[model samples]
Target: MNTDARSHVHALIDRLPPVQLAALETILQSMLDPLSRKLALAPIDDEPFTEEDRQAVAEADEWLKDNQPVPLENVLADFGLGMTDWETMAKTPLPEETGKRNG
Candidate 1:
């Protein structure tokens, strides 16, 4: 299967004219985003982070490394959740708890 796919790609490249071939090569070399608006086979976006964001990320990473747990079913139920709940939580607006908590 791999050999067949590779041969197919080679055949497509062989059929292209010199200018088109060079354009294809340029696309291959560029770190294009796949999720971008373009129809090309590269990524869409690669967001760079600020130093504060990076520091917060490092702190979160260390926290997770020290204290992650396999949550029990009862705990999930207490949070009014199922498997999809976590994914839903990700889509919601950021909570005010990140800053100073209100009484």
Candidate 2:
């Protein structure tokens, strides 16, 4: 983390009441478990935001909010492989035919 971010966190912690500070300490310590510690140490990746993805997510959220018909299964099926067929798909070769050894 940057120096500015560290200063900001310190400022917030310094302003907390005794009870709130204890609660925050408890929550922070709980996150230090073996599995959670590994997750916390993982690097954060930045993904570029695309207009198409933003639009799709907004539409899906609106549909769910209004209790409208949302075709999630069909949308997922169009990804070409289903849950059971994922292993078979992983073993299949790519469409490109460049790599081959003719005996």
Candidate 3:
């Protein structure tokens, strides 16, 4: 974020009541959780891949070369699901709770 935007956010945070601050913290964490997971999973530049990782990548490449890409619609149809179903699924909460505030 730019300095101005960060300053604005800080000002807003300073004005928030304790309960609201807690809620804001929760909301921000939820927003960042996916990004944090992706970052954590991303390979480090200095780290070497294990033999298993190399084998998995090779197998995946071979499979991709051998098989034609299937249309997403066809795949979804096989499961009796459509685009709408996918959209709904994407919006639905997972079984695990993140302890988000109800309000």
Best by TM-score: 3
Clashing pairs in 2: none
For model 1, residues 4-96, the per-residue Cα lDDT tens digits are 999999999999999999988877655453322134543656877889999998998888898975576667889888767865665444566
In the range 2-91, model 3's lDDT, one tens digit per residue, is 999999999999999999999888778767776544445558889788999999999988998989878998999999999999878766
Estimate TM-scores for all models: 0.30, 0.34, 0.42
Candidate 3 lowest-lDDT run of ten: 33-42
Cα deviation of 49, candidate 2, in Å: 1.7
Global lDDT of each model? 0.72, 0.73, 0.81
User: What does candidate 1 score on TM?
Assistant: 0.30
What residue pairs are clashing in model 1? 33-42, 33-43, 33-44, 34-42, 34-43, 34-44, 35-43, 35-44, 36-44
Candidate number of the best lDDT: 3
Ranking by lDDT: 3, 2, 1
Off by over 4 Å in 3: 1-49, 98-103
Give candidate 1 regions above 4 Å deviation.
1-47, 69-78, 84-103
User: Per-residue lDDT tens digits of candidate 2, residues 1-103?
Assistant: 9999999999999999999999888668657554444455657867788999999999998888879673755655898656567655444554553387566
Pick by lDDT: 1 or 2, better one: 2
Query: What's the C-alpha lDDT at position 95 in model 3?
Result: 53
